[model samples]
Target: MSSKSDTIQVGMTNTFACSYLPEQQEQLLVLQENTLNVELFEQLLTLGFRRSGETLYKPHCPNCRACQPIRIPVKHFSASRRQKRTLKHNRDLSWSIVNTTSDEHYQLYQQYIEQRHHDGPMYPPSRAQYDNFIQCAWHQPQLIEVRDNKELIGVAITDVLPNSLSAIYSFFSPTQEKRSMGSLMILIQCRIAKLMGKDFLYLGYQIDASRKMNYKKAYQPYEILTANGWQQSE
Candidate 1:
């Protein structure tokens, strides 16, 4: 593992319109390195860094500090009544972990972006875009496919670390919104982490003001990384 003394070069990107919040601009502190191994990447994750393809970055907006990194303490997590009901409702769906992405997975991703996130940046999804956004050269992400009866319904892109799993991204069949596949995917990651004896399941950023990004709080008791370090949330 890379120690605190190991130097990872970082560069800030110019401000851009915030995707999650309107009327707000966003900037990112990007890791500038030619090669990043799993050990170094894992160390960066602990410091609030996240991966997008091969690039690692974190929010560095000068005017806002709303993007808080959150993680689930696998041993301490207790699903709420609503989350329990969500799991029960989707009991028929089966999931499996795969190391590579498939054409079917891309098809599902395209549909998800078109139907659910049409207004967002990833709206016009294509095969090249899908590959570039999810696949990384150094890290092999696990694609957790959730199916119903034999049909593909959801895909959760996750990065397996030495001691934890980072949920890179997830998408489901918009037609099956009733299943609450988003929450189901997160719950599945938590279970996988615990079964693997991992310490935590990183859930990326939790922006409380952004409805689309704030649902992560439901997975309590989670820890939100703050200026004072990770604090347990009820």
Candidate 2:
């Protein structure tokens, strides 16, 4: 029998409104594999691809190249002053990795989207949306759960691959914004990747124009996929 990995297919999407850039359109090159594995996905990650649930895609915009795929070399990474402060501040919190999701996860996600992303496409978060956006159909992702005493404050949707961990999405209690839970969750992912002896932590894309989405570069010693291949930025 031919293996599902024998012949992989890929497709592209029509140009649409760019979610991050107001004046540009966006396009994507998507992988259409019937079955995906960590080894294959890690190869794709090195080529600047990212996952949204079960689908893997990379920006193929004709007129713009704002989406730069970025990843941190966990061994070479140095926390910035602000990121160090974030780590120190979040020391009181506890984190654990799990392969399942719960109502608590959905509740925090709903609250986060309703309060923080109401102006965006995922404003009216629903169970269906939550399932499609965060839960994968092919593989179960590792969810990093953070808590304060007994309260579930944050959840980071992460994909654990053979050589790296991909940051899919993260949501936290909007009331806990002061804790910088978003950044804290990312730091946690990095720590986990380091402990696992992974070489990189794929951080999706680094969009320079979007104030809300451009923070990925803050993780120093990250590499961005370029026409010349993965180039290190110090």
Candidate 3:
């Protein structure tokens, strides 16, 4: 089998203000190729690369190395007391997976960005932004939709690879804050990955300094990328 390093070409982007870290700058090592596919993404995911829309990139910051790629070893994962409670709490909701996006998805996503992330970079949500950010050309992303008696409450955008599942992004009805929908979606993804016989669930980057983006650590016994290789974290 040929290695990823042998097949892919990469280039670095100009430094920009870090989205997660306000005081830092961010740069990305992006894949420079015309033909990108899920099979190729599987290899990139193993190397700490992530997808935003259709672009595949990994952090290559100059001054800071705070953005660490994190993944859960699905077979070995053991949920904490809180996670178990979250699962129990949302047991009443229905979960289904689809391979396409809809206007309803955009409505919920817009509401999520506008209400919860107004102060963030994706604020003033527009239809164009949502479509561009979510849709991809190579493959149709999986939509894990959660509902309450026919009402849409949460959606988790995920990418399915041969050996792993990458969580692209998730958003919930802001009005359902008490449901802990965000964490619930993640827990659901972990379960789905295990059910699909996948080895890992890629939860994107874990930036310890960002309070809002640091919750992936609660998933016990995750592996984070390092200079040497993926290291297990307790």
Candidate 4:
């Protein structure tokens, strides 16, 4: 597989925005065993990246902190009445928290990619691509699958950080859109973090204006990591 790895000294001079920049200086990358780890994550608790529903990250660029992490504070979390309905909505579904990628799992992935993200890069993720997507963490293949008997409905990929559980990716059966399996998966992660006594469940960036990313904003009492500091969305 192709790889990109680097480690830089702890100075702003070595920093740069990766994906979100015309100018590169706001983000820093740390090397752990010559691989890129979350230097920004260390700043997450302070830089405004809130955990909820995958990874730790802040907006990197000339300026934009909308890329905040959305995390659930388990001890203080209360399932909203709507959230409760979402869980009960999928009660018929069963789950198995195992590793990702299997014959059954792959087929489900194929359908989800084909139906849900056809216009996106992973529209037709090769087996290799799918494998890589879930294999980057210490928890390689660590994931959960929501199924209906023999039918695979959705997948949630995650990693456990020092003080948090980070959700990597989640995709549900397009045919079962009414099920809201995506949100249900996050809800499950919140419960898991609570049981494990972890402080937060890290949901990746919550970009408001992007049609593909708008739903991320709903995972509340979310905190957005900004250049100034962590700010509550509402």
The lDDT for every candidate, in the order shown, is 0.92, 0.89, 0.91, 0.64
- Using TM-score as the yardstick, the better of models 1 and 4 is 1
lDDT of 1 by residue, 14-81 (tens): 99999998878999999856578888888888899999988999999978999999999998899999
* lDDT of candidate 4 over 1-234, digit per residue (tens): 243333333322245543333343455322223233444443445444432222333344445544555566666777778889999988888887885468777777888889878877576667777776565452343578888887878888766565767777787779888888888998888887788788877676665645666675566666555556556655
Off by over 4 Å in 2: 1-5
Candidate 2 whole-model C-alpha lDDT, 0 to 1: 0.89
Candidate 3: residue 21 Cα off by (Å): 1.1
Instruction: Give candidate 2's error at residue 40 in angstroms.
Output: 0.6
Model 4, position 217: C-alpha lDDT score: 54
Among the numbered candidates, top TM-score falls to 1
2 against 4, candidate with superior TM-score: 2
The lDDT of model 4 is 0.64
How high is each candidate's TM-score? 0.96, 0.95, 0.95, 0.74
Residue 138 in candidate 4, Cα distance off native in Å: 4.2
How many angstroms is residue 211 displaced in model 2 relative to the true structure, after the best TM-score fit? 0.7
Listed per model in order, the count of residue pairs whose N, CA or C atoms clash below 3 Å is: 0, 0, 0, 14
| lDDT tens per residue, model 3, 1-234 | 398645667789999999889999999998746588888888889999998887899999999999899999999999999999999998899999998889899999999998999989998999898888778888678999999999999999999899999999999999999999999999999999999999999999999999888999999889999999999985
